[model samples]
Target: MIRVLLVDDQTLVRAGFRSILDGEADIQVVAEAANGADAVRLTRELRPDVVLMDIRMPEVDGLEATRQVCADPRLSGVKVVILTTFDLDDYVYGALRAGASGFLLKDTEPSEMINGVRVVARGDALLAPSVTRRLIADVVSRGRRPEPSPRLNVLTAREREIIAVVAEGLSNDEIAARLVLSPATVKTHVSRIMTKLDARDRAQLVVLSYESGVVTPGWLS
Candidate 1:
């Protein structure tokens, strides 16, 4: 079963998510927390597969909690998914940088939310194409210029191209179509790229692609 921990300051919000997620036989809502402090505490104790976290809280916001959970060696298998009211939340990037696997708008469709939990629980990021565009726009607007990083030196020219396309938010199938390759081939390339960069998932690849200057913000336009 995919164990999940719900962390939200509002009782109603937590209840709503629990209700939607509990219906899935493959998922289980293990616990709930109203603050980040408790969220981190419960995470260490229960070690759920996924954490649905709220950004704004009374004490110890989701960003810090995510950092704590992700940074813990004992909690390495845990993934944190930020829950936000807006698609373009200001804290989304920080949360991602702090080791959050992805973010979901609180008002997202029930099906999408359920799938998102499953995605992150299975070690994939929840970065849909739309979310990736917005996230890149936000990073560009903040004047985050790409700089030289030797971490990407291990990648071949083809691998670089694959990573660039990945930053554009294309899935393996989409990338395969664009590159005139089989989906299996594209998936292999992506896996190789991730292994080279030590990226946790596709979201981190997007971040690294931009930060390492493999892809520029203007590519989006």
Candidate 2:
């Protein structure tokens, strides 16, 4: 089962989300926090599989909460999915830099929201964060780049190509078509890439791509 922690300052919003998520057999609403501080507290206490973090909150905002939660070695395996209605560049970039596994619009359909939680919980990435891809490109282009890491050199040529495709926000089928390979083969390559890179999944792969300069931001296809 996917254990989830819901973090939203609005009570009604939290109730609504809880109602929807509680209906899913595979997902369990493990905890709820009214603000970022509470969220971080509950996260460390519960160590949920997925955290639905709002970008704005009292005391500590979701961005800082994500950073704190991610920095904790005990919660290293937990995934934080930034949940917000705004598509502002700041939120996108900030959430990612804070180590969010993915970002999703709260206005997204119920099906999509459920899927987003599931994907992040399973350590896969959401397909609709193209805005994040754009932000990553912009941020790196503006010179807020990270230092080099030799660990990035471990990716094979095929893994490097897959990472580039991921940075472009291409779906698996699209990547398969572009590379003249089958979707299953593309999935295998992606899996291997994640294993080799020590990435929890594609979301972390996206993070590593820009952070490690494996695929430059502006250079994404």
Candidate 3:
């Protein structure tokens, strides 16, 4: 089963998410936290497979909680999927950089939300399409120029191409189709890239791709 921890300051939002996730056969709402501090504590104690984290909260926010969770060597198996209103681009970007596996808009459809949980639980990152655009715009607007990692030179030409495509928010299957490679092959390449870059997950890979200049905001538009 995919165990999940719901972390939101709003009681009604937590209840609603519980109601949606409770109906899924493969998912279980293991616990709930009203703030980021509680969420981090429960995460270390319970070690749920996924954390549905709200970006804003009292005392500690989701972004900091996510950072703490990701940085904890003991909670390495835990994955955080940020929950926000989609307008919080800065928070979303910060969450991803803090090692969040992905994000979900608070208004996401029930089906999509469930699927997103499953995706991250299975070790895949899940950035929403709109979130990807917003991330790029936010990065560009901040004047944080892409500082291509020198380590990028370690990637093969093909791997560099794949990284660019990944930054475009394409799935492994979509990348396979575009590159005329098998899905298995694409997955293998992605794994290798992660290892070489020391990325925590595909979300980190996307961030690296942007900051490393493999993909640019203009290309995204």
- By lDDT, who's the top model here? 3
Q: Which residue segments of model 3 deviate by more than 4 Å?
A: none
Error of 1 at 116 (Å): 1.0
- List, residue by residue over 102-184, the lDDT tens digit for candidate 1: 88888889999999998888666777647556665666557657687899889898998888888877778889999999989
Off by over 4 Å in 2: 127-129, 144-150, 171-177, 180-192, 218-221
Ranked candidates (lDDT, high to low): 3, 1, 2
Q: Summing lDDT over every window of 10 consecutive residues in candidate 2, give the lowest-scoring window.
A: 127-136
Which stretches in model 1 have alpha-carbon errors above 4 Å?
A: none
**CA lDDT of each prediction against the hidden true structure:** 0.85, 0.81, 0.88
lDDT pick, better of 1 and 2: 1
Task: Please report the TM-score between candidate 3 and the true structure.
Answer: 0.95
TM-score on alpha carbons, each prediction: 0.91, 0.82, 0.95
How do these models rank on TM-score, best leading? 3, 1, 2
Better of 1 and 3 by TM-score: 3
